[model samples]
Target: MQKLRQETQGFGQAVPPAQSAELIHTNTISRGTKFGFLGPAVISLAVIGLAPLAFAIWTSLYNYNLTKLASMRFIGLANYANVFSDSAFWQAMGRTFTLLIIALPVQIAVGMGIALLLHRPGIGFLKTITRLSLVIPMATTYAVVGLLGQVMFNLKYGVVNQLLGFTGVSPINWLGVPEFAFATIIFWDIWQWTPFCALVFLAGLTTVPPEVEEAARLETKNWWTILRNVQLPFLIPGLTAVLILRTADTLKQFDMVFTMTRGGPGSSTELISLLIQRVGFRAFDQGLASAQAMVLLVITIVLSRLYIRFFYREV
Candidate 1:
């Protein structure tokens, strides 16, 4: 027993507690190792994301117009003040919101309907193909969609007017007239994005447990009742997600307007993004454009937070 105990003590002394702990610690990440792993990510974000943002904010504080380089001076908050009081800027904001108000609901409602239609049990191969086809519009480049809209709404030779001729109606200026131009853009946006909203809602439907749905069906005979009280409750997260994304996107709309109307027909379709582009690029007022962009960024963040707070987990 003494000999065995002596051998055990010798084996234990071979590696001290401190040495064992050090070895274990080395196997895991140390503070320096963690920093090594995260250093590239931090540096990349600072250089790529934060550097431009800091530059833009700094530029916004100055009276930096490209044409009048000699007149450049630090006029703190003057650009922001101008953005608030500028009538054209407000008009552009109003047009952006107007399009959002009209298009958002239509997209959500149509998309939700399509999702419900496609969310049945045991989806077949043909139905799967049909669902996959919906992605084509969403996957198409927005620039391409804008160009397509330009061709489709070209008053005289457009397909829409050509079709109207069959019904004995006169050719109407789709993109030339202010009201029609606005409507045409809204229609084009809806056509392109409704598929995306449908996909989101359909994914939400899959997350709804079959047992929960069965329980709800047992309580309610009406399909509308089940939809309103059961399915919609489970779909809130998806609905809120789509709403926030669409709102941000619609608020910053520029590509379609730029390609199709160029904010023409007396600035009827001048969205906030188009206005910012014109101010920064066309008018060479970099400070004012940066300020406008900051305002847009703030609005997007606030609205997204509001959506998350109100509808995220309420269901």
Candidate 2:
């Protein structure tokens, strides 16, 4: 019994210590490898993203005007104070949010409808063709889209006006008028982005298990009921991704709007982004623009946090 016990103890002492040492060594190597792989990316982010952000914050503290570089002096929080007091800044912010409020829901609805249509079981070739068509708008660059909008929405020689002429309706100055111009911006955004949302939702739909869908259909012939109860759970992740991406994109929307309107028609489409551009470049008030940009950054972070906290769901 003593011999058996000693052998067991020896076995345990020898095997466990050796295995433990090997495991510890492996863990150290794993950690070192992970850090090694991550080092370059971390350095790049610090250099590219954090450095600029720090510079912007520093620049915001001064009365930096490009026109009067020699007169540039530190003004502390005065630029931020000016931003809050500026009516134009507030108006621009209002216009920005108004676009987001009006456009997001329309895009989601239209995109979801398109996704549902595409999700229906159909001829394989036709489905491929239809799905490929959704990529057309998404593949177009922002600048190209803006240029296309100019040609399509032109007052006289535009395709839109030509179509209106068929019904004996007068050519509407789509981009020249303030109200129509804003609507045109919304329309262009919708046209460009709806396909993206549709594709995302379609991917989500594809994840629905065949057995689960079959069981769901057996329980109810109502498509809405099946979609709500059986399929929506699978869509949560995709929906979250779409919401985050679209929200960020819309908040920073500059290129297309810049090309299309240049905040024209008497500042009608002067969104916050355009306001920042005008202040920074046109007015050459670098400090105020930096302050405005920092404020926008804060707003974006807060809104993103709100979306993640309230709507994000794992599936």
Candidate 3:
């Protein structure tokens, strides 16, 4: 037994226990190195992103009117209260939400269809041209699209009305009525952004394993079933990402609505961003604008979080 114990001790000594303290020291050094590399980026983010947000929050807390600086009194939360009570503000919010609700599903469905078509095999030269064409609308500026909308939707002599004349339909005032104007904006948004969603979906399609898809095809032989059960599951991540980004962007949409309609006819097209711009710049009520902006920020964050929670529950 003593001899066996001596042999075991010798076997143990052959390798020697690893130096845990040395390993810990090396890990600490690596962590420090990573942080050293990341420090500049962290500082830049704080300066550029966080600093502005902090300033906005601070401004929102105080009654800091740009025009009435001398009379500006710190009325905590009064501006927020006023925004909640304002009828025009509520109207703008309702319109904004209405547009979002109408546009989101249409964009997602059309974009996904486009992506599926583009991803299919057996396309050579056509694929390249199709991709390039789809990219053109997304590449164009929103302001440019809005300006084009203004010209194209003109009542009397616009190309749209002229096109309708061939079918014996009378010239429709595309941008004159509130409903038509809102529809025009939604259509413009869908046209410009559907390609973006398609691109994202296409990228997600690439990540799906081809073998798995083949296996599913063999099992069912029904393309729709495969798409719903296999392709759609694979697309959830891309869909979630597109939804979050588009929701935030659509909520803050200003340039297109501003350029096309100027929130006019009767403030029927006024989105929250337009309202904020009017309050801050036109009305010179910076405090109220800041308060509104803060509320918008909160709403955006909450919506984003809810989406993330719902979509990413598995993760």
Model-by-model lDDT, in order?
A: 0.87, 0.87, 0.84
Query: Which one wins by lDDT: 1 or 3?
Result: 1
lDDT of 1: 0.87
Number of backbone clashes in candidate 3? 0
Task: Give the lowest summed-lDDT range of ten residues in model 2.
Answer: 22-31
Arranged by TM-score, best first: 2, 3, 1
List clashing residue pairs in candidate 3: none
Tens-digit lDDT track of model 1 for 216-277: 88888897888887788878988998989999999888887798889877898889999999
TM for candidate 1 is 0.87
| Per-candidate clashes, comma-separated | 0, 0, 0
Q: What clash pairs does model 1 have?
A: none
Sorted on lDDT, best first, the list reads: 1, 2, 3
Q: What is the TM-score of each candidate against the true structure?
A: 0.87, 0.90, 0.88
Residue-level lDDT of model 2, residues 32-75, one tens digit each, is 45678998899999999999999999999999999999999999
Candidate 3 or 2, higher lDDT: 2
